[model samples]
Target: MNKIQQQKSENISFNYFSLLSLMFVKKYNIQINQKNEKNILSFYS
Candidate 1:
């Protein structure tokens, strides 16, 4: 029983970390895209 509970908690923590990392990656991608757009605009100007 204790082992089962431990496994469940570990799974939950792993899922939480996965979600956090996904969000971080998405935010990073958005920032990079915005930076690229600014560079392009500056080049045109």
Candidate 2:
């Protein structure tokens, strides 16, 4: 019973970590895309 409870907690924490990492990755991707767009615009200008 105790082990099951511990496993549940671990699973919850793992899920939270994955969610945080996913958000971070999405933000990083957006920033990279914006930078690329800016570079392209500057090159054309």
Candidate 3:
């Protein structure tokens, strides 16, 4: 209700969003790397 509380809430939400974004990015990176590997293998074959 107060300014301090509102700021705290905003900080928590921001942290949650950042953590989710980081996890999503990590998963995406893994998928991209796997796809690259597959492509390289196919190209060689």
Whole-model Cα lDDT per candidate? 0.92, 0.92, 0.91
Model 3, poorest ten-residue lDDT window? 35-44
lDDT of residue 20 for candidate 3:
100
lDDT of 2: 0.92
Candidate 3 regions with alpha-carbon error over 4 angstroms:
37-45
Over 1-45, each residue of candidate 2 has an lDDT whose tens digit, in order, gives 999999999999999999999999999977887879987678779
Residues 2-43, model 3: lDDT tens digits: 999999999999999999999999999778878799876787
**For candidate 1, lDDT tens digit of each residue in 1-45?**
999999999999999999999999999977887879987678779
RMSD of 2: 5.6
Cα RMSD to the true fold for all candidates: 5.7, 5.6, 5.7
- Residue range with the least summed lDDT across 10 consecutive positions in model 1: 35-44
Instruction: Report residue 35 deviation for candidate 2 (angstroms).
Output: 2.4
TM-score for model 3?
0.67
For every model shown, what is its TM-score relative to the native structure? 0.69, 0.71, 0.67
